[model samples]
Target: MALKWVKDNALNLGGSPDHITIFGEGAGAASVGFHMLSPMSRDLFTNAIMQSSSPTSYWAVKGTQETSARVATLAASVSCPVSLGDALLPCLRAVDAKLLTDQQWTLVNRWFDVPIGPIVDGAFLPSHPEDMLKAGDIKKTNVLMGVNLNEGIFWIYSFAANMPLDKEGATDKEQFRNIVLAIADNNATLQTELLKVYSKEFADAQKRRIRILDAASGDSLFKCSVVDFARQYTELGGRVHLYSFEEKLTSNPWPGWMGVLQGYEIEVVFGLPLNNGSTNTQAEKDLTKEVMGLWTSFAKTGTPEFGEVEWPMYSTETEDYVKIRTKGTTVARRLRSHACAVWAGHQFP
Candidate 1:
């Protein structure tokens, strides 16, 4: 309906309806992807830009059953009458916004550990996203999507700060093991295999357990799923442009080793002068300009033409992408396929 309005009113506002692009980042990116997969929204948007998110992301995509449970929990938390069934929507609507929001956050943090995101509710999402994409339910829109290098660093940092470990390695070790077990359904064999792989990677680290868990969280939580979505979409003959945002901020925002933490692309993409209180360098400004141009041009046309490098459409054979960097932007191929393969064994939800 909103897209319809935009299409109808674009010409009056001196814009072309045919040039409409639906772009979003983070969970908003998930929304964009959701629209792409929705049968009702086919060709409503000419192009899409999804950064740091995709339909395959576990937390971003939820089941209707879980969504119902969450709704019940939120209602109960706010002292609403859950047994009313048909009357629940009106009851919830009448609750004070602040009270409802607080209760919802409390329930979300207590049980899920992650914020509530979009759910597959049969109508908007006819089936699981994997099924939808595999069965060719996605619009063949031009897509630009990618992830940050260390998207999970700040997540771990938050966990560490809130749940202070008694000893550096020992407490984190146990916690990491428990986390892996919880994620793997207490499967001893899977837990052991995951630990072994991570142990080998962080063999000489000062904080071995932290590094191991961070790697697992980042890859499993976002990167692998993103790669899977991109691969499936590309195989379906979509014009996909992938990228990796590798530019570290001049001054780190989050404390302790937040290597390209999630959403870092926002400032650079918008050509913001200050990044966490540090002034942008000339190189950073130039890179920002290039990024803005590529994104805007892709919205106008279903192609990204940036500088000397013509960013190629991602194919099953090449899996190519343009690497965004403050120093230099260049074409690079493949995501962390090896790490992704490791996560694939666990069959991440």
Candidate 2:
């Protein structure tokens, strides 16, 4: 409805309906994926840019029974009677909105678990996202999708204050294993496989342990699924420009240990450094221009080809992706191939 409204009134609003490009980050990025897959949203947008999320990500959708269970739990928390069937909606509607919103966090079983998300409603979703992708049931459009180098640090730092870090503020082997177990849902085989994939081989034990945990968390939660989506989409003959946000800005407020954290690309994508009263370095400002140009150019031409670096179309064989950096953008192959293969073996949903 929203997209239709925009399309219907684009000329009246001094915009072109024929040239819409939808883009978002995190959940919003997942939403762009949903729009891409949804029949109701077909022809609403000509291109999409998904950053750090994918519709096929494990947390992006829940099984129907699980979604219903979560809704019942939420309703129970607010004294709404879920057993009342049709009455439940009104009961939930009667509850204070802020109170209902506050109860959502209690539904989380793990740091990465999203209690509320899209479901296979047989209408909007039509089928499982993975199934849809496999059958090529998604809209054929230009796709731009990628993730950050250390996406997991965002989640780790969220609970870091309550976590037990060493004097050097790094994770130990035991702590790292515990984190991998949580990410693997306490499955021993999966945990062992994850540990092997992100092995503790670095000479520095502190950095090794931390990096292991970070890689496990980031790959399981974001990168692998995004890659899977790209591969599936490309196999279906869709144009995809894959990328990795590798730059950690000098003006980054997070600890130096959190390398290229999730959502860090937002600043450059939106030209935050070029804003008034900004203290970003000249290099960052230049990078921001380059990034914004790529995004706008993609929206305008369905290709992010700008400047010296030639961004290649992703394929299952090559799995090429652009590494966006403050120094310069360069093409890289097989982003996390080994780790993604490990995840590919595991069944999601």
Clash list (residue pairs), candidate 1: none
Per residue, candidate 2 scores C-alpha lDDT tens digits across 141-165 of 8999999999887787565555543
Which segments of candidate 1 are over 4 A away from where they belong? 105-116, 162-172, 179-187, 202-204, 274-278
Error of 1 at 111 (Å): 8.2
lDDT of 2 at 198: 73
TM-score (all chains, Cα) for each model: 0.88, 0.94
Clashes of each: 0, 0
lDDT of 1 by residue, 244-330 (tens): 888886644654354688888887777684345557677777787888898888888888878788788888788888888877788
